[model samples]
Target: MFENLKILRRAVKAVATKDPELRVQRFYLIQEPQVEFLDRSTHYMNVGFWDGDATTLDTAGEALARKLGEAAELRAGDTVLDAGFGYGDQDFLWLREREVGRITGLNITPHHVEAARARAEAEGVTDRLDFQLGSALSTSFEPESFDRVVALESAFHFHPRSAFFREAYRVLRPGGVLAVADIIPIDGATPRMAFKAGPLSFLKFSLPDENWHDGSTYAKELTEAGFADVTVESIREKVYEPWRQYMAGRVDDDEYRRKLGKALHKGVVRHWSGQDVMRQELDLLDYVIAVARKPE
Candidate 1:
């Protein structure tokens, strides 16, 4: 009972916090404790690619990573830049499977960077992985520094994602690939749909500052940023529906609900429940994977 009270207080406080960065920090702080109970081997935060009944959360996540890698044409001995790398799960996968030469992970959250760094060290890949605390919009890396740049489900939070495109183009070597998996307002989605999604969804997902651009807009931005052969593919049915179903199943489980309830009170599980509402009733958004290349 006392623990529940504490959790409720945290949830209230999280809702009250107006600053975006502080809210993000509070949200993750609530999530940290729950990580131990989750599948720690692949701490993926993205919506996974579910092919069929054979897909588990980990495998789905790996499939998404593979999709991004294929889009980027990732190869051994390539230096990759991972923008907004959540927990560096995909980085570990890439290291193990793709045999990438090196990875520089940039994330706005400090704890995520620290946790990812620790995981890399534990996996004996610290020499090949570097985690930095920073934003994707503006990075400090030198020009033409990376062979590939990728953001897995994180670009949506980049305020005006166009800036990140230009920055990626600046940092990537000629002929380097830029790949992203992101969420956007569905093509031709009406204003009413956005309104129905509600403010909580927007705040929780950090979608407001993103300008909610669709796939075509993203492709145009990449092209304007000097990327050639830009392609944006909507995989909403494959990603959003399956992901929503998976999350709904998890939330339906008694044990998971109990844990989530506690986490919600503590503000660690903000906006998760709201996702179901968005998925079921709103249908205002789509999941897309985009790829482009810098010309030589």
Candidate 2:
């Protein structure tokens, strides 16, 4: 609620900047269209490049699944759930690899579910993949329904992070695994780095105006929510250089490269007053992933 309050103030300020005749849909931290587009576009292109097994993992979603899947000894035939299944890449990979028996994906945005379904159809894995619109914080699924649940880089949009973890625990079977990858504040809840990173990153994270939390903070939240053996692995360095080069390589050689690149550049500048908000995190992970499990 604190975060949402801050965003409400910004929205009011923005309305002031405008004619004040039009009321922005500032309810629930919805970003201005331009900011949302830029953030999504950059994530799509950059993650697409880093995701080697994109048949299942999406180039448009987070890239840590492949690593975490391996780290957790996850393999084919398990029932998997992609909690915030944007682009359906992680589940897609699971489906294609036959790693999971079937994967149920839930996403808040209809647009993501639409694209994910289409991709599943095109890839001929429709039978093994299913996606629907729902909030990760309070999705509807029977208790003990899955063997593995993952929310890759999509957890931050879920405020009071505890709720999100609690929900994941609710639906997960005992001993089922839960994995989340997202940005957290390092030095308390400071908005400084976030403000500098600008709206592009903040919008992507659905950050409240601007808020940051350290990785440890999220780890603690996971534990509080009843996830056992919580672990936080920083994949920042491996991702930084590769992600930058990948973002840089988004243009040329592909179909929409020029158009998307141009749009991305303009969007970045519009939101952050610069076209390279992700530039600074080239050394450490812009964020980290937290993995935990429901006790058997």
Q: For this target, which candidate reaches the highest lDDT against the unseen true structure?
A: 1
Query: What is the C-alpha local distance difference test score of candidate 2?
Result: 0.59
lDDT of 1 by residue, 161-206 (tens): 7889999999999999999998777753445224443323443435
Model 2: worst 10 consecutive residues (lDDT sum):
19-28
- Model 2 bad stretches (over 4 Å): 1-63, 192-194, 197-205, 209-211, 248-286
**On residues 1-296, what C-alpha lDDT tens digit does candidate 2 reach at each position?**
44344544765554443221122213223443343343343223123324444321134243465665654446678877776666666676556554678888887666568878988888887777888877766766888888888876666655556777888899888998888766655555354334454433434334432225677776787888888989887766555555555444543225434444554444433443433555653322355767898998
TM accuracy, model 2: 0.70
Work out the TM-score per prediction.
0.84, 0.70
User: What is candidate 2's CA lDDT for residue 154?
Assistant: 64
RMSD of 2: 7.5
| Cα-based lDDT for every prediction | 0.76, 0.59
Candidate 1 versus truth, CA RMSD in Å, comes to: 3.6
